[model samples]
Target chain A: MTEKIVIGLDGTDTGERALAFAKDLASKIDACELLAVYVIEWSPFTFQTAEENERRHNRREEEINLAMSRIVDPAVEGLKAAGFKATGLVRHGDVAETLNKLTVENGGTQIIVGRASSDGFAKRIFGSSTQNLVMHADVPVTVVA
Target chain B: MKNFVKFGLTAAAVTVMSSPLAAQETPGIDERVNEAFAAVTGPFVSLIFAPFPGTEFPWIVMWLVVAATVFTIYFGFVQFRFFKHAIHLVKGDYADPNDAGEVSHFQALTTALSGTVGLGNIAGVAVAVGIGGPGATFWMILAGLLGMASKFTECTLGVKYRNEYPDGTVSGGPMYYISKGFKELGIPGGGFLAILFSIFCILGALGGGNMFQANQAHAQISGIVGDYPGWITGIIFAVVVFAVIVGGIKSIANVTEKVVPFMGILYVGAALVILIVNYDMIGWAFSQIFVGAFTGLGVAGGFVGALIQGFKRAAFSNEAGVGSAAIAHSAVKTKEPITEGFVSLLEPLIDTVVICTMTALVIVISQQLIVDPATGNYLLNEAGTAISTVDGNTGVSLTSAAFGASISWFPYVLAVAVVLFAFSTMISWSYYGLKAWTYLFGEGKTSELTFKIIFCVFIVIGAAASLGPVIDFSDAAIFAMAVVNIFCLYFLMRVVKKELSSYATRLDAGEIKRFSH
Candidate 1:
């Protein structure tokens, strides 16, 4: 059976490091496939005015397109060029939840994510997405420093 | 620095000119401004509020009631049958993960709710019950219930005929549905009605949405901080509103979206506490409502009077059939236009039926509205208005007094909530007005900015002026919107029925996904 690995992309150098680590691990494993996923952080509970709500769909699509072109698509292309089977997924939702859901759907054996810089007080109190994934992800999570 | 000095000097001159001491010497600036506005707006106000021939009822209220009733019947009591499904839609049980839009059904409802759930619930209900007696609450609840079908019809058509621009931003409201739905049905005069509706929408946004809100927010603040020049409060409000609109400050909008709902909950929570504490009076309050609704409790016009106030306030509060909520609901991410309509019906139930009723009940039970024991009627003053225990306070003050009587500290919290409510309403209506303005003048930054500046200016004018002509003009403009909107709803409702039937068929066939357990 093929081993599927899910890599979280944040469009940063840290994400590149996580991808590199996953790629190195994939080379060691036989019949491995890599999935590059970019999750746009979104919360449904926030209030918006009529105009804001009207524009939100367009904005979400723009963000997804931008993420696909600038991060996920290039990474997937690089992986494919380097002789690895790779794909891309972009979605709007909680970062950890989207990542985990995608992994479960794809039957991913492991999830890899970069350790995003934790700077804000909210992050300290609520814990980072990496922490959340580590705690709740069904598959093994590899966190790159 | 030079511009700041110039602005400061100009403000100081206006402040001294309009000061109370200067007013004591002669007719004040406030009086002059009020008189000027009253003169210009008087005839229009009279025309709008004109009693139906040989009756005390205003034709506009009749227009709204007839439309709501027709919609309710035409849809087979949709508000009652689909009420549970509406809740399911709002909860995202049927939300397809692949839906195109970012706004969930819940967000659309709250956004629209914040707009409609302002002074209408707090002060408008007070005015309704104040004059109409407790009986008005009964009609208000009934109107709110029927108004759900009105919202459902307009919102479904709103989504069906919405303008999806090349930029991906969407615009939809009565204007869109009236014009597009009519055209699709091969009807004439749709364009004329659309233009007329836009004009009324702009006026309604400026008057009822901007001015009335500012006026009430100023009144509440003055009640708390002791009387002062309203222009001071007006200028402050104008500056903040200008920042939110012209400065494109998302943070302010974000903060308002977060805080106003919290305040709404806090206001309702306090009302619930008072209701629980006065549990013995609940039955008595209901009796008063029922009795007043039918008998008028010695109010000037009696039964008809209570019915009028109840319908008027309910129409104004929930804004069902008014088409503004349609604009907000049009943005929801649903392939089925009827799904948004289902979600939109919950608005009136929350606004008038629940919140406005709570305000009315609190006022009734607090003993603020004094009643004569012998006559079993509310005691009337020289003007034939109900006399309240708190110095015969009316509007927001009466509401404040009612809550204050129960919690003592509630008036202060209420004052804060009133200001926030006013601010949020102003923001929402600014967009509504801007949409109308753009429809007339075409979409561009200059047209948008002109409306924004005008809206902000009206805020100051609203806060500074007395209730007299400002409120009259506000009511007139808002009802005028209903007149044009409901007229269109009558014609376009068939399209909505079609959408509803299709949605129901698909839903029954299990074509619609249910994501929740």
Candidate 2:
């Protein structure tokens, strides 16, 4: 009967903070089940090829796994250690849509992730993928710095 | 007279009625590009060679080839030994495809391959073989082999020093390793070298990756769209590329995963069809490759001199020790850096071994006998600049010519493929440069934005302006990066060796499990 929160994590530093806080909130509330989610970015390239793209995908998965292991795993483990229920999910499609899907999937109340992380490149000319995700995630969104 | 007019009108009408065919016949663009390359790269050929002046030091690549060949023998041709394993890696036996990291191994290879796999394989090898002859392919294969070790070392270091953010994002490459590795060595200039590497990377991205890519794309677009001013084509490409690049690595990965594969198949398929139809010529073409490599049949000078040209072309195309491919390999997602390193070894094989050979074979098979394989080069009659091709011609137009000979529709298809390949390559290189940029400068938003914007803008310049000096400077910067990067790799080969052995043991002991999901 507790209000469970669905948090969106795209694996940015800010997302890390949000996930950490969400785990704590879930442990305290006992009513909440934490959903750790990620959205895979797709473009024309992913849509176009079959086996040729797999070579790069494998390399990417290795890095992505390492990343999830570092951030989501610890938080997920921490919540479990405290006897709180936590489920981790990775979604492909647009970041925003996937995060929205997770909210409905979990009957969740909140989405948490990083704000526009400062890219050490050109500014004003670009927006972070996380920023794009935050702008569209329909649930009450929290961007942890 | 009335009958003649009717025939002329009918002919004109027929041409106008053909939509795609009409759109594809823009040889004018090829002519212009050929002229432009001659004006710039042609004149500088001797100059670029004059300064460092030794067939000796700067060309450590030659020795690297020797080293790689020796290592391959010592390890019992590990490239062949692990061939099956590499194939499995590509199959994602251990991959979940949806896993984190910016791209798939295949996509990463293509993305990296795209960056390394441009005209260098096509035009570069052509020039090398033209000047150096078939002996160049021998050296090229040799260099590529040695390049495997360098690729292993750099990619392993790339992952070893890589940073994974709390958001599950990763940032890595030579810049990270060069700086991090130096820090571990207690070297003072580590920071400076890292930044320098970054600057070189940015310059390369803009010039070689961005501008050059855009320039080639514009050439192709214009080929398809005659009278479409080069600048307009450049702007459109720049905007689209900007849109993708602004989204960062995932966006790049997302695009490349598809683009790289599509283009590779299209290119390879086109070449294969050409080779099949001309299957009879395969015998003679390869005969030239072996015979020209040693006897220097058509070359003016001795056999050794002609052989050197082949080596030069091979080096230019495969880029065995250049370290650019390492930048791509560093982005892989595995916990074991060596897995990616092993995967990294495939770049030269795919790029040089499979693709480059296809490119060469296409040209050699199609070329007229007057185009000598021993020194298969000549001056563009109008441009008066020395040019080379597998057939021993100078222009990318020659690539199209071969395509045209096999399939009636092939020239157009190949043109589109070349443009896409060049564009994807440039865009991918942009990321490599950006990582380096961030490495040198503080991770500030303004600095980041400025570089990307500048990089985007160069697409227009590359398309519209003179490529002569720009390409030279860019080539120098890229090759210069190899000098700096390889120096680090040589000193730090121990780390790569340790990782390689450890991973080998893991594989042997079944510590590394094959993937099910």
Best by DockQ: 1
Candidate 2 residue lDDT tens string, B176-240: 88778888877667767777777667766776677656665665556555746565666666666
lDDT of 1: 0.87
Return the lDDT, model 1, position A57: 79
TM-score of chain B of 2: 0.79
Candidate 2 segments whose C-alpha is farther than 4 A from its true place? A1-145, B1-77, B95-104, B129-135, B185-188, B221-232, B246-257, B299-309, B312-316, B372-393, B465-471
Give the DockQ (2 decimals) of all models.
0.66, 0.09
Model 1 DockQ reads: 0.66
TM-score versus the correct structure, for each prediction: 0.94, 0.67
Give the Å shift of residue A79 in candidate 2.
20
TM-score attained by model 2: 0.67
lDDT by residue for model 1 over A75-143, one digit each (tens)? 999999989999999988788988998899889999999997666999889999889989999999999
lDDT, residue A104, model 2: 68
Please state the error at residue B293 of candidate 2 in Å: 1.7
